[model samples]
Target: MAQGIRVLHVLGNTQLGGAESRVMDLYRHMDRERVRFDFLVHTEKEGHFDKEIKELGGQIFCVPRFRLYNFFSYRKAVKNFFEGHREFQAVQGHITSTASIYLPIAKKAGIPVTIAHARSAGVDKGIKGKMTRWMRRNLSKKADYLFTCSELAGISVFGEKAVREGKTIFIPNAIDCRLFAYNEKKRMELRRKLGIEDKYVIGHVGRFHYAKNHEYLLHIFAELCKKEKLNEDLKNKKSFVLLLLGEGSGMEGARALAEELGIADRVYFLGNRDNIYDYYQAMDYFVYPSRYEGLPGTMVEAQASGLKCVMSDTICREVAVTELVHTMDIRADAALWADYIRETADYQRKSHVEEMQKAGFDVNGQAERMMAFYENGNFDA
Candidate 1:
């Protein structure tokens, strides 16, 4: 018999995404001899973490994406998997859109724990978004545990009543704080390498999805360039630059919009990166005008790196682990957003490891809490 307590995590893929990153952080810190994780991702394409997961002694299973017209086939696939494989102590549904269908199947198949882990507060627009919200309507009732990373996410997916009645558990999308902690030497080195040593660097780290509001971010950059009085050194037309990190369908759209807005020269799409934490060191400020989020780990990463962040109010206020984070409505004008970033650009930067840990956003502490739950099915998160 295998000695490790095996837990299965469901996600879109092992890609460098918010939920995937958080789970990987937890997995990295676990007592692997006593507990291990296996993944059930929706894609057949290999993911960023696939090699590492295998090396760490974990399994990966794949299923085709679920569609309304193929509900029967999807349900059959899930049922067949759970009925045949009985190794999992728990099935964690990070992709909660289909949890209402899968968790009950896991429970019926004798899995001791079923978790609906809501990682985002909003969905895609139009038909896709409507379908997703419909699918998640009964997710809370289907799971033994309703796990959410933020208050807004909990209320949004699990329903306000379930959250209010104390049925929902708050799990900070914790991270390795030490990795992102500020270092002046590293900052200077990266700035010089990127040739932005003298320019004011505003940053963002996320895929160029509809929710990330890339177009609005560009508009903000254009506005920021117009505000010469904000800083003397950066008052030159070319002194302020925006560094966009991550790739997606919206990337070309963002680039085109940058050109249309006449700020193409100032915007650099760095694409997806392995050393993302370093960019935080090089940046003077961070802006995330997202339409919605669960609990963005980048906000924690930004705070850990001591970068002042101005994000949309749609993000849960709980991510404000420190006073470094400020919010604005999504409806607000780009000029107003620029003013906030420019006004706060004068603050000193420092390490926030202590603050991050104090707010329970550090991985080490939560790893213990999660390990205890998986080892003996004791629930505390």
Candidate 2:
């Protein structure tokens, strides 16, 4: 029976990102007796989801990092792991940027079902990035199933022709919506704890990376500070603070930029909190100026928390499931973002739990749907 089948999910470290968070939400909601999940991550270090994954009866296995310099060694490691574990019912890979490398290894190991998933709509530029793209394009042919978070993401990883021919399965980046729904008690409590009770809080939940446009975000916040100083109605009031949540390779650079811009004191870098829902509740506005995205789960959570969201137009429109979201061009100057934020800063919070459920982004429903998909080994639905 498919009830006790185990699935292997391959990816980078299981950290706190959109892709990681969505998978965890599904894992938490899935019926454990019907389906089980195991992880094959690249890093040896324990991640934010490691303890929870273990407590849920899932095993964590690690392999050496995949690199062009160590191609032979990486391949041997993957081959050995798959050969040793012949019991995995299926292997689903979430590292779209490099799925071509590992999916072929899984296929060669005789895995019956091989799934390649796309999670982002953009890639880095330059020679190295071009080589990665070429590798992905050639190696992605080994997968039996193609999965993507959005149409643009599907096109980015698997060519437009492939997506047009119905070759990819679209999966919404679902979440536990009710947990992030507007909560006045949580808002007041978190605000008090964070010592931001009387301040205008502008929140953003994303890694500090070039793709997220953190440099531009700092400029916008600096402009907002300048504007606040000039407003006669806010002369004695404290300036709005920018709350940055999450960490990444660009963390040091982002902090340096904030300091150089003279806004270091006004920006808080809260790195990877377990209780992200409370941060959402405490925020008054959510700002995201990413260069591009597949389908951001953070924007969904922000709306679920009833925060007025301002995001880049490059992000897929499918994420705007609620009226709280607003999009602006990524090329627009920081002054424009400041003006828009100041203009829309006083909106009220309301419950959007039903709206999220109606949009088919509820984790419980998606978890069941995905379980059925794994059991049937079909993408017809």
Candidate 3:
């Protein structure tokens, strides 16, 4: 048997965030004999990714989290990199935080290859944006390759510089279709258990943060409930329920908004669930109203789960791999989303099963791609 390529993945933390989850997904399925994986995480608190990484026969090296402008942390990372340089053939940084801070260190360590992967749109506009752009311009040059989940994310960070330089590659986020496939029996069972078996459930699975626009989702649901109560025909024909799965700092505010709008009873807050795919199965329709995203894994998971999705325009187009998904504007307008929810509820969309199969987003395919990148510097551009 041929020897496996060794890869060291450096990430901000092991938290159950998008980038962390993507790395886990890749690690879990990569061919054991083709690519061996390890992780360098920056966090004082051990996170959910730790166990999964260990289970996959990978090692985790924890480093102090680097605050912006913290030269000391950079020096520490540099020291750590030199101490552990011999174990891996290449180092891959998964998001901007790691890429901006560690790419230079990895380059200096003389790793065979250093990859900086862009996983989101640039930082918010203003001072932070300016600083981030400057960092990317200077720090990114050290990376042998730049990988982005979408072209939009690449342009948002690197702008014309990436196109002119010709180093950025777009690799859309892939999900395990088998894990998220349509399971009618499971859907029915889960819906019955949630006591929303008869209601039209509109689902949103994500951390409750500003980017997710949960406040707007509450207002949208409120508007739909009011409309259902006022219009006798619509009321008699349809009733709606909301399933919010995930937790974050914004949870209390979102809960308060639901109460203020008097729709608390209609919304279910299932916080920080491990089996998120089951919640997707229980829903009638999926909605992602994020303000901005590189590519939402929930959106891809929803499509794989065979739920028709209604998302915001700011979400990366890479997640909309099939026609079953729909996009909305990001103005946080309640009435507009309510209208869309109603229209989407009425439309009979095709199941995404075949589409997901055709797309080849299953874990095996995704792992193969990452293995190729690690072993031969081959990535689908």
The candidate scoring highest on TM-score is 1
Model 3 lDDT tens row, 55-124: 7888878777665777676668656865677667888887564466577666666677888778777475
Question: How high is each candidate's TM-score?
Answer: 0.96, 0.96, 0.91
For every candidate in turn, the CA RMSD to the true structure comes to 1.9, 1.9, 2.5
C-alpha displacement of 351 in model 3, angstroms? Answer: 3.7
* Runs with alpha carbons beyond 4 Å of true place in candidate 3: 124-130, 230-236, 347-350, 379-381
lDDT value, candidate 3, whole model: 0.76
Best by lDDT: 1
Clashing pairs in 3: none
Where in model 2 is the C-alpha error above 4 Å? 230-238, 378-381
Better of 1 and 2 by TM-score: 1
Q: What is the C-alpha local distance difference test score of each model?
A: 0.89, 0.86, 0.76
lDDT of 2 by residue, 1-381 (tens): 466778899989889877888888999998888889999999998898999999988999999987778888988898899888877778989876667777777777778888988888887767766866777785447689988899988888888988999998889999999899899999999889989888889999998766798888899999999898654443246569889999999999999999998899989999999899989988888999999788899988888888899999999988998888899987888999989888777656797888988898888888878888888975332
lDDT of 1 by residue, 249-359 (tens): 899989888888889988888998888889999998899999999999999999999999999999998899898889998798899998777766777789898999999
